[model samples]
Target chain A: MQPFTYERPADVAAALAAIGKPGAKFLGGGTNLLDLMKVDAETPQHLVDVSRLPLAQISDEEGGLRIGATVTNSDLAGDPRVRERYPVLSRAVLNGASGQLRNQATTGGNLLQRTRCYYFYDPSMPCNKRVPGSGCSALKGYNRIHAVLGASDACIAVHPSDMAVALAVLDAEVEVQSASGQRRIKIADFHRLPEAAPEKDTILGNGELITAVILPPAPPGGQIYRKVRDRASYDFALVSVAAVVETEGDRIRSARIAMGGVAHKPWRAFEAERRLAGAVLSDDAFAAAGEAAVKGAVGRGHNDFKIPLAARTVARALTDAAAQKKA
Target chain B: MRNTSVTRRGLFGGGAALGATLQSGSALAQSPPPGAGAPPVDVSLKVNGAQHELRLDPRTTLLDALREHLALTGTKKGCDHGQCGACTVLIDGIRKNSCLNLALSCDDLEITTIEGLGREEALHPVQTAFVEHDGFQCGFCTPGQICSAVGMLAELKRGLPSAVTPELAAAAMEVAETEVRERMSGNICRCAAYPNIVAAILDAAGKA
Candidate 1:
């Protein structure tokens, strides 16, 4: 790693101020930032260590749970309140990374984690997301794990977060702090679509620091998280589903559906949610919802498998949630 | 510092008494204190029971610092990318990939490596069980596997649930084979020694 200035601030306000400087980045758990530094992927001139800030707290609020941005994945998953009330959030976090990573990775950093696209990590490759106008290598290269939804002509990278998919399904809110002050953004809008600007990832402005994430109270009833992957663990999802449903008898009262490993962001299946909201839970309804979820999916040669896999995952998750409700 | 005086007196008397009783071929009782050159970069490390205050590079990783600087070579570095668990160690009782962690980050913390597992007369159950079950081939990833298992056991004891766990709110449940394999997925053994490793860990947990 190159020589750089390091600062350990005392509090969040000072830490935010220090990170607002030109070319300054906040160091949370250093899982991603430090790895990038070692390979010279991201070379920040200054590092503002925000690890000591008291932002690791998880508190119960009137509206919902306020998870400090610095809360480690392990702590969040292990929290009694989180597990008791928001099981989807806990399950999503547990499915990500590894034991060591879960202990070091913060909630904010997990959401802001870059895609695990191989080309993007290797600077020698021509990745438009890594370098603007450089062209996308995955377009013609190995794209088995690339995006099949909401992908642009310039980039086909998929977001590598399972927790973000759950958050999107839970309708969470992200609180950000900057020089101007604090702002709240809905989880669905936090991640940007890779349209013309594939390089830009999040909605946060430059010099903005993620302060906390507020998970609004979950809707009544059953929730299920199912992630399909090549390996059992410590690997990114091939296709994952976060589904929560409320039903009266066999009729669905309401439903929220989101997908991962198939899009640049947590791809919310708004149409699927609409299809299942007032419909009855059955094989026909599940098939229809799955079809609606991938109605606009455009698959590449290497990622064509994801279309069927994602649709199947949505269907399986819905079936499992219905079974859980029956029990 | 005053305790040094009594310790020096005791050392002198003991040295004189054992001088003739020891074998002539044996080397000196004291190894030369590492050449007093510029105070070895003043790194204070409390690894296991011993405390080391040495000088070293600022960029050294904890894995390198343990294997090279301190000569505690029990920790092994596999991929060095934090992907392989062959360099796992406990910093303040929390398992971490030593290869990816900087030594400077562990200034005031307690570090426990494989060397701290057991002595010649007594073996930590995990270490003894690994030997009995043939839980290694090249043995490169064994140290990390054992260390990570130690941390994993601690997590389970605290009622921390895994993704595969059916119920997140349950406590003190049996650790099934599938759950163990899933929890230990972070460590990779090239020799395909996972079956024996899981057996050894299960045996140790049963004993505990």
Candidate 2:
């Protein structure tokens, strides 16, 4: 951690002004920023504290659940309305981090948490995310938990939030406020792939503050979040599944599925969902959907197992979601 | 009685002097105080019922603040990274990773550490249960485990969902042993004393 100026702004306007400078960073939960600072991955000249601002509200506005970006992961998961209206989001939030981390981490910060690539955390090791174009050591060394989707020659780190996967499944939108104005970005576009510039993680501009996340209500049906990891707790996913299925009269009417621990952004299983729509969701349909989801998955030597594991995880998630209809 | 009073008075005087020096030395020296009021910045955190104002680099973590600055060294630093929950604490009644938290940002929040849970004569229920169950062996992760258990109980009381929860039903039920294990999974014990840890938490929750 380095010596830097700190300011606690009362509102969004002040916070934006505080971080409008070239080298300032917005401090939300400090779960990510403070950890990065310890190893010196992020050395901002100033820290704009947005925790105190009244940005921790979760309310039902016209659009859907208006989840204040600073709302803690614990609160978001525990909120009755969120659970009732959007269990996928709640399950996603709970699957991430741990009970302690979920308590302190903000929804906005969770989506923006840096890659868990061990090489990125160690400055001595070359990683394009930490120091762009320096090199990608995870490409070869200790690449088991690296990525199997959304890879470029420059980087192949997986986006690490379970909540982001659920958001992608629901087609949530992010509300960002900046010095200039406010804008809403689809959850998929909010996070970017490596794509030559692996350093740029989110579409958020230099001074933009994530205000809230707007969730479009889940269609009447079932939702499930399933994660496969080395440990049942506190570990990042090897492959995770977030699926919402609307079944009508023994057939799948509509489906939205996204994957985590396997891609750069929440890996939307669009092809898989397309295959399931209007088809009776039997064992064969789910297997085909799972296959479709991982059709283009390319894997490194250590992580080749993710291709099948992710497919199975997605298939199991759909089965689980469908079972909820009967329960 | 007179001999004991004399020793107690002497210790009090030394403690008071140390506290005063820690608070006042920085501004006069034009350099950051020995550990007090200098900048980068001086942060006053109300941790476990004590007010500690210390001069630190803006990036100093709350875990460092508790262990290094105030000497409430119960909170262990395992990974230093947020991946491990060894530095878990309760700020405003919610569990958080103190290593991933900045000391200055916690200025106005209520912080609870393992020290706050017990003394030589008395123990918090969680601490007592841990002892009874032999929940820990090396004892390195006890502080974080206890703090995390407290947070886990609160989450269950609030009806928070877990990955295993089939749905977000509002039904109030005993936090099952399996639920406790899944919820507290973040705090890893290399010793693999999880079965006892779960037993302790279940016993504590019954009392809580």
Candidate 3:
């Protein structure tokens, strides 16, 4: 890893001021950043450590759960209220990384984690997301884990976050701070697809720091986060789904769905949600909704399996959500 | 530990020693980018109840600091990239990957490695269970496995649920065999000694 200045700023203002310089990056859990640095994929000259900031609490505010950006993944997953009220968020976080990594990884860092694309992490390979205009290696070379939903000419990498998928379905919003003032950005607008610029992952400005993630009160229903990976443990998702459904007797009153490991960002399954409304929460309904979710999903040679696999995973998630016990 | 108001420890620890380390250095940085920090940063850590201070590069990982700087080699480093739990340690009583943690970021944290688990005369219950069950084969991953088990038990004591946990609202989650496997899935053993490892953890949790 390259040498870098480490600053533990006192307040949010100091942290913002310190990172205003060039080649500076906010150091959140250091799990993804350090691993990327070790591979020479990212070389930030200054690290503004924001993990120690006094913003690690999870409280009920803003009409729902207000999760501080620095709240450790383990803490978030283990919080009783979260398990009781928003099981999807807890389950999604538990599905990610490892126990040791989750203990250190923070909520905001998990949202900002980069893709697990093999080509993107390789400095020797030409990845447009790593270096703009360099051409995407995953576009043609060993592209099993490349994006299936959103892909521009420049990049085809998937966003590797299970928690973000759940948050997307839960109607979450991010609270951020810049010199001007604090702002709230909806979860859907926080992450951008690789349409033109693949280098920038989130809409967060250089000097801005994420303060908290505000989740609206969970809908009256069951929630489930299901991930399908190569291995039973410690592997990135091939396809994952976060599904929440409110049923009026056997018919679904409302539904929210989002997918991960198949797109540049968490792909909201709006069509599936629309199909689910006023439908029975049955196997046939789930299967059709799953098909609707992946309607236009394209696949590379090796990952052509993911198309059907994604549909199956979606169906499984919906079934699991529907089977969730009455609270 | 507050960085604002220029606490006395902060001023002396960062400003004074930084110049000395930069000038009369000990092979300061390996791959120093042109704009990287020129001076080594001073950090204080309490490992196994002993307070130790060292000046190291800002990028040094907590695992390297333990193995290299402090010579506490009990914590093993497997796949350095947080995938394998061989580098697991207790940071402020929570299990975390030391390899993924920067030493400078853990200034005020209290760390517990395998060495801190127990002494020779009296072994930690988990260590005893591992030995009784023959939980390891190569023994390379034992330190981390033991440390992780200790921390995991604490998590379970607080009623954290695993993926396989059937009842989320259960008063106290049962440490069933499958629950043990799901909880210990992060600590991968290339030797495939999972059966014994799970048994040993279940025994320890049962004993506790």
In terms of TM-score, which candidate is strongest? 3
Q: Give the clashing pairs for model 3.
A: none
lDDT, candidate 2, at A306: 98
Each model's fraction of native contacts: 0.31, 0.76, 0.65
Q: Which scores better on DockQ, 1 or 2? A: 2
Over the stretch A195-259, how does candidate 2's per-residue lDDT look in tens digits? 89999888888788899999876566788889898977777899999988888888998888899
Stretches of model 1 off by over 4 angstroms after superposition: B1-44, B49-59
Pairwise TM-score winner, candidates 2 and 3:
3
Model 3 CA lDDT for position A149: 89
lDDT per residue for candidate 1 within B64-126, as digits (tens), equals 788766777789978777888899998888888887766655677889998997786898788
Candidate 3 per-residue C-alpha lDDT over B69-159 given as tens digits, one digit per residue, 9 for 90 to 100: 7878899989998888999999999998899999988888899999998998889999999999999999988898999999889888888
Chain A TM-score, structure 3: 0.98
> Model 3 lDDT vs. the true structure?
0.86
Give me the displacement of residue A248 in model 2, in angstroms.
Answer: 2.1
